[model samples]
Target: MSETKDTFFDFKLFKRLFKFIKPYKLVFFSLIICVVLLAGLSAAIPKLTEFAIDDSMTNKNPKDFVFYVTLMFAALILQTIFQLLFMYYASWLGQNLVKDVRINLFDHLLSFKMKYYDNSSVGVLITRAVTDMERIADIFGQGLFMIFRDLLTMTVVFGVMLYTNVKLSLIVLIMLPVLLYATRIFQKYMKKAFEEVRTEVSNLNSFVQERITGMKILQLFTRETIEHKNFKTINERHKKGWLKTVWYNSFFFPIAELSASITVGLVAWYGGLNVVLSDTVSQGVLVSFIMFIPMLFSPLRQIADKFNTLQMGMVAATRVFKVLDTTSHIDDSGNQIATSLKGDINFNKVHFSYVEDEEVLKGISFNVNAGETIAIVGATGAGKSTIINLLNRFYEIKGGDILVDGTNINQYTLASLRNQIAVVLQDVFLFADTILNNITLNHPEISEETVVEAAKAIGVHEFISSLPNGYHYNVKERGVMLSSGQRQLISFLRAYVTNPSILVLDEATSSVDSYSEQLIQNATDKITKGRTSIVIAHRLATVKKADKIIVMDAGEIVEQGTHDELLKKENGYYKNLYEVQFLQEKVA
Candidate 1:
């Protein structure tokens, strides 16, 4: 994140960014042409001034003055038109480039493995996708085109100054090295300052985002004052970062102005002597060079500013490209599509870990027949949910062979494989949208009538009817407006409408009210009727009617059988678990 660590000119990175703008090359290059023309016309203005001062004014000829005035006005008008085109097109190109890059960044994010998210911060990712992208777009708006236009103006001005008076141009050139050295020193300091600013921005955002997300927890613990103090500390650090940048700008601009003023004064002193000593030289030539001196140094001043713009953009681009360059996506090279799967799944000697050398599921094996309901009972972190994640291939197992209908899971295309499985998680997530859209998820293939039919079939239609708008009620972010049971019921309908061959109810009733729990129990019966269903439940009472119940401890399965069969085995894992786990649920 340190700016001094990065090169000012990253051609390779710009080359990568170029692809996004390549689609608009006609517009982009046309803008470049306009900038060049503008620069040329800007150079012509001083020459016309010299002509008006020395020739027409000295001769006192009104016709010559009038003709020169008309030509200068035409050039100024043409320059303005080119300037307009450059402004319009440059902004257009920048906005479009960032739009495409942001989409591409998000799409790449979607393909990453679950483990990537486990170790990364949501706030940092949000900054990269949003704030960092804005810095990049500014490259086109305030950086690239402006930088080029300034440089071209300086270059054209330089050549004209040399042609008009070689000695004055050389005198102005004396300040060039000193100005460049000062800029180098200033840039080095500001680069690190900008880096600190960006890092603090991410930190402040992460702290605020987490606190807001868990505001209820802070309130329950009565720690609002403590959290606010902590937030202020981070916010103060953010202020310090910005102040450092401001401090550098404070010292940098005045010195730059001093140097430009000194350089211009030297031009007047040296050029005036030449005007006195030589009969051939004109005061108008001195006047023209005096004007051209500022033009030459103006781009130099902007190079310092615009280079900062490009500097920030390259920094942002580096972070964005780092995300794009990740090789952490799940291997989705399998071409075999899973169409009409028989719902027979097998996990043979599966071993996996979220972190290296710390396995969560160790050499585990299981089989679910075509239409049997298997309930997995386990303590927290006993890897029951990990099984569901593995089955869906959210994380690649280190050593295992998972088969669906006798074919290895890796042999099936990821999208097709995931399409056949439906999961209603312990914590249901609903979008900030209508109840019906949350259920359908914009799946136009699943008609509105079909979703309504599925909801009623699951026995939760009465609940929906009681709501103000029935199915059309807006869930308003994570379904916070609805009761836990109501959200679970919506999840049920979502799963049913999809008609996935394999159904997973992971603690579907663990945190719901008794009324909604009963409805979910009834819906569970209907949803698991013919599919290969797996229920990971904390309450053993909820799994009594399951075709088979598997008990797990740590990372290994210790016992599994029918409920009645497991009840007879004294001191067995399932028998002991039934007493210990269910008693707690009853007490709560």
Candidate 2:
């Protein structure tokens, strides 16, 4: 994400957001027009009061008084209609703009490379997508329109005050410079306060999200008190951030009121003096200034308050717009279409590093022919999983050429390439949905009957049938309703039903009961049948019948052979790994 610094406002960010509002230009302009007309009508109200007092009440002219009153009533009616239209159209424009912005951000997120997710916080992204978007929506829905209303009120009110009686107006204007200075100071400090508040809010959200998602682990380890203490610390910081903003608000509003009261006092003192001297100033003009002075000052006070909203909204816009402008996504420039892949895979001298200058995979190379099953065994942090990640183009290799059917993988569109390669990760992720939905993943073409048939072929149909709702059972969040082995079985069935040209399985190392093991082994056999398959081997017995076993150590391949042939070597890497990591599985 691009960094956001505290400024009174961010014009550049608004320029970017204005693009989303382009589609609703007519509605936005109409809202502006209504505000301008409302301001003019509103200014006319005080002038009507001066005319009614001077020409009707003082002179006792019933006809002139009735004329002014009737006109004021007409203005009020027009004002009400414009206000309604302004509100309705403003909301419509804001919601429509926010909808477009939300879709744009989500689409951009979908294109981001896996590397971005690896280093970013999910909670921060959630905050940006949801909370920040709402704040931005308020800019148009409430803040901006209110600001325009208040500003126009002040401008129109000031112009009439000067025109009606210049002497009283100048007396009232004496407080303007001081108030203006105060407003500038308020905007500066409040902008800083809100910037800090948003940061704290994001941090608090990230902490809470992680804690709730990992509540199971916290309970299992009995770390509730420890975690709660940590949460309190974060919560306190969040509260403090908001309190600072409130502090500035508390100080600023009272100062605004004090300034306005002083202006009123000056107007009364000077206007009363002129009347005592029998000067040209009329009583109606003095009273009009009294009424109009507050109108001007009230908007000034309100403008100060609404400017807070405007500033906060802009801060949120800064964050949301940054995401929309992000360029750290997969480059889908390749137009090559993949109708069918031959299942022939090759990695030639691939080099990669998750962090700069710290290689994870060092000059690794491998190949698998069509219809071959290759089992890869390795020690932890040995680049075994990285190879599979590269094959799917999840991460671009630092230096290497990965080809399928002799064409570079980069030459194919990511969608077309990934559609043909299905992977069943060790940590399976299932939506809080029914078993059937989890398997089919809402694919229109993949029917329930087809999913059930695939489950039966993989030998997991009996276990699924025994569940309370069978295929309709809701797994709950992250498949919490299912056991680890049961979830693994579901993952296997999910991959099997995909029927892709190539399959990649990150074998789970967790222990399972004998029954689940038998089901898994059978499912694995069916999925790997007649395809180029790569298995990150976790059990020696599971891969003993494989066509080849490749052993990796510290990003280098040190052993390559079938199970028996590798065991015959005295100090073969595969033999040592089998004894240490998978010996118990073989004994079982």
Candidate 3:
């Protein structure tokens, strides 16, 4: 993520944020009304004090004193009511907007191609969705309207001060430029500090998420000490980012305080000289001016602080909008739906690359007639998995075409196309959910009975039933409670229940024990009986029964034939690969 430049106010971002207000315009306007009332009432209280002291105290009139004090009390009550309304509605508006934005962001993320996930950090994306979104809520809750309210209150306070006595008002105005300059400097540096703080927060989240997820690997390699040191370094940088903001606050706030105190001192000195030397300024006016100076300065102080809040919110908004603005999603413009697919697949000179100009699949071509079983074999990074990804439209090919049922894959809707295929990947990911929910992925249409029947057909029903909760047992995160073979069986069961026309098992049987392998072999035979199946396996034995074997090396197919025919070519890629694996099995 790149740094968001330090900007005191971004009008475009503000305008974009206000667009969320369209849904809750009534609450927004009511909140505005409350803010206006609160500011007006707050400013009016001090004037009532000026009247109480001048008309009643100096004249020794008790009735006037009672009248003015009663009015001040009523104004205070009204101020409290409006303040409560302001806080509640402001928070309500902010939280609702956050909810909407968070949902949109998550939905947008779901639409992105697998290629996006390949390059982006999970932890960083999580921070943007969760932490950064919370910061945006502050824009409404404490930022824009609060700043406006303070400015309005200050305007009223200044008008009253000037009306009461021009000389004292002039004295108060003398210190304004010095304080304003200090605030401007503070606001500029604070924005930069906040940007650093947000950046460090994202870094910390990404580091922690990756570290926790890969903790097993870290421990297996005995890198605890090194990892601890690395974490400390990142954490220290996060601390320093925050400390910069603290330093700025500590420096600027005192300057604001001293300026306010000096203005009050100057007002009192000038007003006192008038009260004694001449009757130009009354003691009542002097007292009111004393009360008004802080009002004028307090808003000035709060405006700077609120501006910092506004900056932080805008920075967070910029990061979020960047994600929303990305066009990395696979095009879903095709309107054709894949229904009752015959499962005929053809890859016509397909070319693809994860990185620019470095092909992962180079002009790869193959054909699978309806209900035919094919196996792809190669060394690691031979682009075997890339074939499965393209088949499922998880990624778009750079050149050539992938056709399903004799129709170009791009012509079918992405969801409908993917629904016709079931892929059980090498690395199985299971949410922390019940076995039933994990198999059905919480689809309301798939019942427990259907899952059990599919499991029985796949030969894993007894294994799942033997668990503590039977079919309802929780798999935990990534099925950590189950052994590697058990997890693979669950993944196979998940695919079988989908009953897709085209089934893909990518190295599904490679990691299982002998017993699990036999069960998987039985399951494989049962599910692939009349469905188009593509199996990519490292073990030669697993692909021996495949209708056709396609040999791939680097990014291109080297050979394609039946198990017996491929071995007939003495120096062919498949013959050599089969010979090496056979020798390895003999050695074992």
Using lDDT as the measure, which candidate wins?
3
Give the per-residue lDDT of model 1 (tens digit) for 171-260: 888887787787787778777777788889989878888888888899999999999899889999999988987887788677777778
Write model 2 residue lDDT over 1-588, tens digit each, in one string.
Answer: 233455555667778778888888888788888999999998898789889988999899999999999998999999999989888887788778888888888999998889999888889999999888888888888778888898898899889888887878788878988888888899888888888888998998899899999888999999999998999999998999999988988998889889989988888788888877977777778888888877888887777787888877888888877777777866677889875677999889999998999999888888889988989888789998998888888888899899898999889999999888888888889999999999988888899999989988888898899999899999999999998888888887887887889988887534556678778887777778898888888766568868888889888888888889998999877777778767876677
Candidate 2 stretches with Cα past 4 Å from truth are: 1-7, 276-279, 508-511
Taking every candidate in turn, the Cα RMSD to the unseen true structure, in Å, is: 1.9, 2.0, 1.7
Candidate 1 residues lying further than 4 Å off, grouped into runs, are 1-6, 273-280, 583-588
Worst 10 residues of 1 by lDDT: 1-10
- By TM-score, rank the candidates, best first: 3, 1, 2
Clash counts for the predictions, in order:
0, 0, 0
lDDT of 2 at 274: 86
Clashing pairs in 3: none
lDDT for model 2: 0.84
Report the lDDT tens digits of candidate 3 across residue range 1-588.
344655567887778877877999999889888877887898798889989999999999999999999999999999988898898889889989999999999999999999999999999999999999988998889998888899898888888777777878888989999989998899888888888999999999999999999999999999999999999999999999999999999998999999999988888888899899997998888888888888889889999999888888888999999999899989888999998799999999999999999999999899999999999999999999999999888888999999999999999999999999999888888889988888899878888889988888777889998999998899898889989899888888889888899999999988889899889889888889899999997666668889999999999999999999998997989888877885586477
Worst 10 residues of 2 by lDDT: 1-10
Candidate 1 differs from the real structure by a C-alpha RMSD in angstroms, to one decimal, of 1.9
Per-candidate TM-scores read 0.96, 0.95, 0.97
Better of 1 and 3 by TM-score: 3
